[model samples]
Target chain A: MSAMSDDDRRAWAYLAAVAEPPCAPLIALAARYGAVETARMIKARKLPAGNAAVLTATQARCETDSASTDLETAHRRGARLVTPEDDEWPGWALLALDQASTSVRGGGPLALWVRGPANLGDASAVAVGLVGSRAATSYGTHVAGRLASGLADQGASVVSGGAYGIDGAAHRGALATGGRTMAVLACGIDRDYPSGHARLLEEIGDHGLVVSEYPPGTTAAKHRFLTRNRLVAALSAALVVVEAGRRSGAANTAAWARNLGRPLGAVPGPITSAMSVGCHQMIADGQAALVIDAPSVLALVEASGHDNFVRSPATPIDGLPPDQFEVIEALPAHGGLRVEEIAFSAGKPVAAVLTALAVLEVKGLVDGSSGVWRLAESW
Target chain B: MSAMSDDDRRAWAYLAAVAEPPCAPLIALAARYGAVETARMIKARKLPAGNAAVLTATQARCETDSASTDLETAHRRGARLVTPEDDEWPGWALLALDQASTSVRGGGPLALWVRGPANLGDASAVAVGLVGSRAATSYGTHVAGRLASGLADQGASVVSGGAYGIDGAAHRGALATGGRTMAVLACGIDRDYPSGHARLLEEIGDHGLVVSEYPPGTTAAKHRFLTRNRLVAALSAALVVVEAGRRSGAANTAAWARNLGRPLGAVPGPITSAMSVGCHQMIADGQAALVIDAPSVLALVEASGHDNFVRSPATPIDGLPPDQFEVIEALPAHGGLRVEEIAFSAGKPVAAVLTALAVLEVKGLVDGSSGVWRLAESW
Candidate 1:
C-alpha cells in the first residue's frame, strides 16, 4: 500500500490537486522524469514541447493552493490517493487505457483518489458499468435496477456515475441486493455533485467505493462529466447503457467504450420512447448489441471475453417432444417424407403425426410441405 | 395480356384448383411439359421423376371434379387465374423464388388466383409486407398499422394476410389511408377463412387485390398459413415483423425473408413484452434490422436496394448551429487543438466554444478532449 515514497506521494498529490486528469504533458513528463521531478519542473515554470497551456494553468493554481493541505483534507475524508505506482491501484483497467484513444489528454487518470472498503483491484476485475440518462423513464429505471442487481448478484461489480436517474437506481439496486457497487464521480468523492444523492454516495463509500480523479473540494463542471466518462468505460470489462436520450452523457461513455474496444451492451426500451433512440441507433449501426436483461448482458460479456464464448442452442433432440423427435428421425436429410410415411414409420396416427410435425415446424426443428415433412437444415 | 391459350389457361386453372400452391412436383412437371401437357399426364395417372405423391392425390381428386367446372366457379366468384405464362403474373417475385429453397415442393406459386381490380404486377412492384402474430397486443397492432399506413403513403403497396391482429390492422391502416393494400390469403380469395375479416377482405378486393394460389372454396389449413408465409416474404420489396411471439408465424416469415436475401426489419417493443421476443431474437441473430418507425423501415428499404444506397447524414454544414459548425471547421485533421486555440480560430468566447464543442460531440461531428478538440473520424 505504501509503494510510493513520502516525497513521491506528495508530488503525485500536488499534480493531481492542481491539474485535471489526463494532462498529456504532465503524464508524459512524469513517465520520463517521474512524478516528483515533473512536479518540480512545472513549479519552476519549465515548458514542455507542446501544449503548455494546461501545465501553465496548473502551475498558476499551485502558487495559490497548498498541495499538502489538499492531500490532508482527502485523508480526513477517509480517501487515499492511488497512483499507477501504488500497490492497491486497479492497474489492469487503467493500464489498458494507456493504449486507448481517449477524450482527455492522458489516456486515463493520472491517479485515482478513492474512499471505500472494497478493494479497487478485486472489485474492478469483473466490473460492468450501468449508466444512462438522468431523466430516465420508470421503464428505464426498472430495467436498470434489475440489470444492476443481476450483474451484482453474479459477482460482477456494478460501476456508474453518481447521477440522479439511472445511476442512482443502479447503485441502490446493488445495495438492496446486498452486492458491491462503486460510484465514479465527476466531482471530488467527498462532494456529491447531484447534492441529493449524498446519502447514497456515503453508503457506497461505506460498503463499496467512491472514486474520483479530482482532489477533495473540487467542483463538478459540465466538461468534467464527459472527461470522467472515459474512466467509467476504462474501468469496466463491459459497459451497459440502460437507457439514454439521443444526446446525453451516457452516449459519451458509450463512445469511449467503443473506442477502447470494450464490449458495449444497450438495454432496448420501447422505440416510441425518445429515451431509447440512442440505443436503437447504436444497435442499428452495429456499435452495440441489444441486451434485454441480465442474462443477455452476461452472455454478451462471456461472448466478448477472450475465451470466445459460444452459446448452445436452447433446443436439443432430448429436449424435443417425443413424437416430434420421432417424426424428425423419420424424415430424410436430402429430401422430405410424406406425413403418411412418417406416421407409418413412427407408428403414430396420421392426424397425430401431422400435429407433431406442425409443432416441430414452429420450433424450427422440421419443415413441412404438402403433407410431407423434413428435418430443418438448422437441425 | 392473353399470353396463355385457352387450353393452357384451363390446364393451369385445373392444377391450381386441386393442387396446393408451391406443389414442387407440379411446378417441375409444368416447367418440363407445359401446363396442358402436364395436365394430360396427370389425367393419365402418370408420375414425375421424384415426389409424385402430391400430384397423384390431386389427379385422383381431378378424376371426379372437372377442371372447367373449377374455372367456372372461380370466374363466377370474380377471381381470374393468373399463371406464369400470362402478362399479369407478377412474376418478378415468384421468379426470385425460383432461386430460393422453399419448404413446399415448388419454390413458389405456379399460378395465382386473384380477385380484384388492381393489377398484380403494378401493385406488387413496390410492395412492403407487414406481418405479425394473430394474437398480437394492442401495441403490436398499433405499430403495424402505422408502419403499413406510412408504407402505403409512400406509394408502396402494403401486403399482409387477412388474419386478425397485426395483419388485419396493417390492411385496415392502408385502406383507411386511402392507399393501396393487397391481402395474400392462405385460403381461397373467395372464402375469407377468419369470417370476422370478411368485410375487410371484401373491401381490400374493392380497393386493391385479394390473391391466393388455391381456387375458390379452399380452407385455411394450419400448414397452409405456414406455407403462405413464403408468399408474403417473396412478394415484397421488404418484410417487417411488427410483433411476434417466439414461435409465431411472423417468425417463419422472417426466416423466409432471410433465406430469400430480402431486406428484413422488425420493430422493437418493450423488452418486458413476450410478444417482442421473436423480433428481438431476429435482430440479435442479425437476420433483421431494428426499425423504430415507418420512416426508418423505408430508410432501410432504400439503403438495401440495388443502388447500394448510402444515407446522407441528417446534419450537414447548414444543418448545424453556426458556432458548432465553425468550431468543427476550426479543428485539425491530423491532431487536435486546445479549446483556446479553437476559440481563437472561431472568434468566439472560450466558454461559448466549449458549449458548441459539447453539442458537436453529441452530434458525433467532433471529438473533444482535455481542453482539445478534433473532427471525429466518422464525420
Candidate 2:
C-alpha cells in the first residue's frame, strides 16, 4: 500500500498528542470526515457539536503544528506512527473494538505510536494478554512468568502492560524463553513511565514491540492507564489474569475483553491470597473461566494445536506390547470405531483387539466411550 | 416411633456383614423383601434370582450365624446398629442417595454402624463435606483446616473420611473450633483403620460421629473406601475439595457430588502444586466453582446467612450524620428502593438523599445499580 499522505499522518499525530485516547466523539468525527478534514475543522473552530473547552484546549495544543515535530522526534527515537490505513496496522482486533462498546467507554485508537522491531500485524495476530496486580505476590509473579514463557515457547506472543510485578515478570519470562513479547504502555513508548523499567522496556523494543496511543513526550497519567487497558485487551486473542484484587485496573481490562467477546481466563491461587480475590470472584461470577497452565489458556483461546501443547504427544506406541501398539494404530484420530471394525482393520481377532484396547485405555493412550474406541485427547 | 424390632436389627446386622456396601441389587432385594426375609432367603440359599457367585459367597459368610455375635460385640464396643427403619437413621441424605446414581455405583449403607455422641440426623442435616488427597501438601492441609474451622464456626458440621492429611486436618480443625464433625470410616467404626488416627477418631466419637457400614471387625478394604465416598457426598449440602491429584479418591467423591447435584466447590492452591490438579481440572471443566473462603462456599451451597458471615453487620448508621444515617436506614435489606422513595422515607430532599447514597456507596455501606440504591453485599 502507498504510504499515508503527509496531511493525514500529521492529522493523526496531532490527534494522538492532543485528544485523549478513546474520545468517542473525536473517533466518530475522524471516521466520518477523514482525519485531515476533522483536524482542519477543529483548528478553524468551525466543528459543530464539539466540546468547546476541549476543542479550545486542543486547538491551543496544536497551534504550533507539533505534529511534524512529534513525527520527526518519533523517527529519531526509532518509533513510527501506525495509522489505520497502513497495511501493517493491527486492524482486526481494533475493528472488533469499533463494533463493540467497552465497559470503560473505550474504543479503538485513531493511531498507534509504536517503537519496536516486530511487525504490528503479526505481533498482534497471536498475542495473548497476560496481566495482573502491580502489587503481585511471589506466587502470582511465578505463575504469570510460567504462563508467559509457555505461551511464547509455543510461538505465541505474550502481551502485557509494561508495569511492575506480574506484568514485568510476564515480559521477562517470555524474553527468557527466547520468545517474542509486547508491552502496550499507558504512557508514551519513547518514555518509560516507571523509570526503573527503562532497561526492560529497551530490551523489549529491541526484541519485540512497544506500543502506545500517547505522543512521545507524554508522561503517564492516571486516566491514561484506564484508557490504555482497552488496547491491551483488544490486541490479544485472549486475556489471562494472573492475580488481581477485588477492585483493580486489571479487572477493567477483563471487562473490556469480555465486552469484545474475547475469551478471558483467570489463574486460580490460594483462597487465602487477597491478590487472587478478583480472579476467584470472576470465576465464581461466571465472568471468566479458570485456567491453570499455558496449555489450558491456549485451549480456551482456541489456538491451533492447543491439544498438542496440552500434553506430550501420547506415550510412544513402541513402549507397548506389539498387539496393543497395533490396536492403538487402528484407532482413528477423528472419530472412534467399534471393536469389530478395529479388529478387522488391524487384522486381529475381536477378542484380541478388545484386550489390547483395554490395555491402551488403561495406559491413557486410547479411550473408549460407549461401544467405540478412539485415540485419547493427549494422543 | 417404636424401637426397631430385635429381629429387624439382627437382620440388618447380618446383611451389613455379608454384603458389601452399595450392592444395589442387594439393597433392592432387602428393600423389596424386607431385611429379615432377604437375610433368611440368602442364608437358606433360597434366593433364586441372586447373582449366583455373590449369593454363594454370602451364604458361606453367613453359615457361621455371626449376626447375633456381631451385634453383641458391637454393643460391647459401644456401637449401635442403625437400621433404615430406625428413627436415628440418617435417612434424608440416604434418600437423596437413593434418588441419584453414583459414579462408583455406590449407595447408602443398608444399616449404618455408629459409635458417636452426636445425633445422626442432626449431624448430617447441615453437613458440608471437606475432603482431599491423603498425600496433601502443607498448603492443602492448611486450607482444609481453615475451611473446616470456618464452616464449624458458623454452626455447620463437616463430614470427611477419617484418613490422614486433609481429612484428619479438617476434623481436627473443626474440633479446635468446637464445631461438630463426622468421620465416615471405610472400615468398621469400631476399628480405626489408620490406627494412627485412633485417638482422633475416639475424640470424634465423643464430640461428633463416627459411622461405617462394615461389621465391627471388618478391615478397611480398597473397594470399601470408594463405596464410602458416596455417603460423604450425600450427607453434605455441598462438597469442597481442598486439594486433590488428577485421579485421587477425592475426584471420585467430586463425581458423586456432581451426580447428586450437590453444589461442589474447590479451594484453589498455587497452580504449581500438583495436589491441586484435579480441582483446577474441575474448575476449568465447569464441573466445580472456585471458592476462596467458607462464606463463598456457603453462598454456593445456598445456605442462609452466608452474606452475613461474609462480613460483620454494617457499621451502625448512627455513626454517620443524622441525614446520611437516615438515608441508609431507609434502604431495605430484601431489595433496593428508588431514590425518591428513599428520600421521602428519610424525610430529606431528593438531591440530599442522592448525595448521602453516593457517600455511603463510597464508604462501602450502600450500593446503587441502575437507578436504585441498596445496602452493599459486604455491608
Model 2, runs deviating above 4 Å: A5-7, A48-60, A101-104, A303-379, B32-34, B48-54, B100-104, B303-379
Clashing pairs in 1: A22-A106, B24-B105, B24-B106
| Per-residue lDDT of candidate 2, residues A1-379 (tens digit) | 2378888899988877767667655665665567898788777777766456447546656565679988998899888999876877886657557545343556678788888889988888778999999999999999999999999998889999999999999999999999999999988878976899999999998899999988888889888888788888888888899999988889999988877667889988988889999998898888888988888888877842221111113346633545676577667778899898787665567888988887888888887875688888884
Candidate 2 residue lDDT tens string, B1-379: 2377889888988888886667655665675567898889888887745357448547557665678988898888777888767777766566546545333565567788888778887788778999999999998999899989999998899999999999999999999999999999888877877999999999998899888888888898888888889888888888999999988999998888877667789888889989999998888888888887788888876742221111113354523664576588668887889997786555456888889888888888888975678888884
When candidate 1 is compared with the true two-chain complex, its DockQ is 0.46
Best by DockQ: 2
Estimated TM-score for each candidate: 0.77, 0.77
Model 2: lDDT of residue A346:
59
Instruction: Score chain A of each prediction against the true chain A by TM-score and list the results.
Output: 0.77, 0.75
